[model samples]
Target: MTDDQRPGEFELIERYFAPLAGPGGLDLRDDAGLLRPGRGYEVVVTADALVAGVHFFPDDPPAAIGWKALAVNLSDLAAKGAKPDGFVLTIALPRDWTEAWLKDFAAGLGTLAGQAGCPLIGGDTVSTAGPLTLSVTAFGTVPAGRMVRRAGARPGDVVLVSGTIGDGALGLAVHGPDRPGWVAALDDEQRRFLADRYLHPQPRIALAEALQRHASAAMDVSDGLVGDLAKLLKASGIGAEIDLDSVPLSAPARAALMADPALAELAWTGGDDYEILCTASERDYSALIAAAAERGVPLAPIGRIVPEADAVRYSGKGGGQGFARGSFSHF
Candidate 1:
């Protein structure tokens, strides 16, 4: 089509996003969305931003980027034990934006939105000179006074995490320019497994109900187990002795570590694993495990909360070790 026939920002929204809008979206014609929590429920809101070069490679597929942008936000809601309701997206794009890219991105976003039962509400779009950026503010709901908090762990609470860790970080290494020589030791299937984990994180929304029932404190493991756990400890006024060896690792991560034991530290400190990390009392642990198992999600107990205040230590087969870095930091 000629320049005059090309779709503008508003036109694109109506064409690609309006259909995905739910009851509160008002057909993309309104300035803001209208959302009301269900009776006896409170709204839980969280926002996350992704920059093209910073959060993802510039050459990554638009669809994957779309899924990730929303998935990360959903992960936050999952940590709070809230059921997702809706989200608003704001995107700043380079001048050369094309209809094809937007179409695929919208498709990806819509698929996850439908699966999570969270529909798009409303958002802003604009042109930018720098890298593409997408921000999503997601809303969820939990029974009044039932939303989980980071500061609820008690001294005797057991530290547990959903699913295996380290896959996302290892996946990044495999996709990076200077991937370690040990990566070559991994088979083709193993390589793809790691890479896929990096591109698409499976938010543990299925475990939210169980977490609300049993967890004393909870948070998603976006930054790194070591560092994020430290944050939880600080918030809950306790310490933890994480059994580094017991920290769950995916098969691919395990294979890579076996090839190069040094990769163990990277597995511990590398970030981007969006699994839920939580603390629950021993009495509730069995029930939590049963609940998660029914949802086909694994719950691994990695450590226990301690009486000491604000300390996180790692102990492996050879005693204690120090991580080069605790977690990913942009600044």
Candidate 2:
């Protein structure tokens, strides 16, 4: 299009986003998406938003921001053992919009959408005087009555987590303004590793099928292990005893903790891990581990569910530790 014929919002949708639209999206020319789940399948819907100085750094790359906005929501669906189907995106842009930034952001979002087998359906865009905000509502499908939930954990069930914890939290410590002094001990490679974890979290979508087959209760850990686990336990009407020593840690996080043991609390409570925290019967735990391993995803048994209601106990070599704050809070 010529400069004088520059596309407006609707035209922009056709030019840039329409290509990513699925059948339900009606080529982005409809008032709303038309989702039709197959027989014996239920739709799983999850939404997450990233804000300029809140969910992510304001100066972070637009592409990374786009990936994270979609990935966080996908993580939720993964926990529920759902298969990606489609999504809707709503963006609030600053008054001064740049085509280059939009192009990069859409590319990042579209790439992941395609990879996950989820297509863009419909959404809205608007101008905002405040910070840029991107919201995504992703849709998925799960077999009827098989969706995993946070309320199915029972006493004697094993608590497990996929991949390492604390990496995302540590990554934030490396780049956040209030970073601990100990972050200085990290070398360039270590810093980059942690920062990348913070910038790009890998959603464990590959293990959803295994989760449905084995996990009794499941949730994606976004608000720190300690707090998110507590939420899960409460929902299940039970309690847990977590071994602080067994909470998985990435190599970079381990090195940082070795530099300053005090960093352990931050690692546990700092949030943004995006790993799956699940509970399964001891009889099924081994099979679940094997299944996840077959897919090249590591599932670590960290603790066990207890009969005590609504209580989370922590124990390790240093004795018991408590957190003044359990998880990340927007308020």
**Count of backbone clashes for each model?**
0, 0
lDDT per residue for candidate 1 within 1-331, as digits (tens), equals 1265568877888889997795445667678987789899999999999998899998788888999999999999999999998999999987677888989999888889988989998899887899999999999999999999999999878999999898999999998777889999999999999998998898999999999999999999999888898888889988887777788899999999899988877777788899999999989988998999999999999888888888776677622656668732211
Candidate 2 wrong stretches, greater than 4 Å: 1-7, 22-25, 177-179, 327-331
Best by lDDT: 1
Query: Candidate 1 versus the native: TM-score?
Result: 0.95
Per-candidate TM-scores read 0.95, 0.94
Runs in model 1 lying further than 4 Å from the true structure:
1-5, 22-25, 327-331
lDDT of 2 by residue, 190-265 (tens): 9899988888888899989999999999999999888899899889999887787888898889899999998888
CA lDDT scores, all candidates in order: 0.88, 0.87
Report the lDDT of model 1 for residue 180: 86
Candidate 2 pairs with clashing backbones:
none
RMSD of 2: 3.2
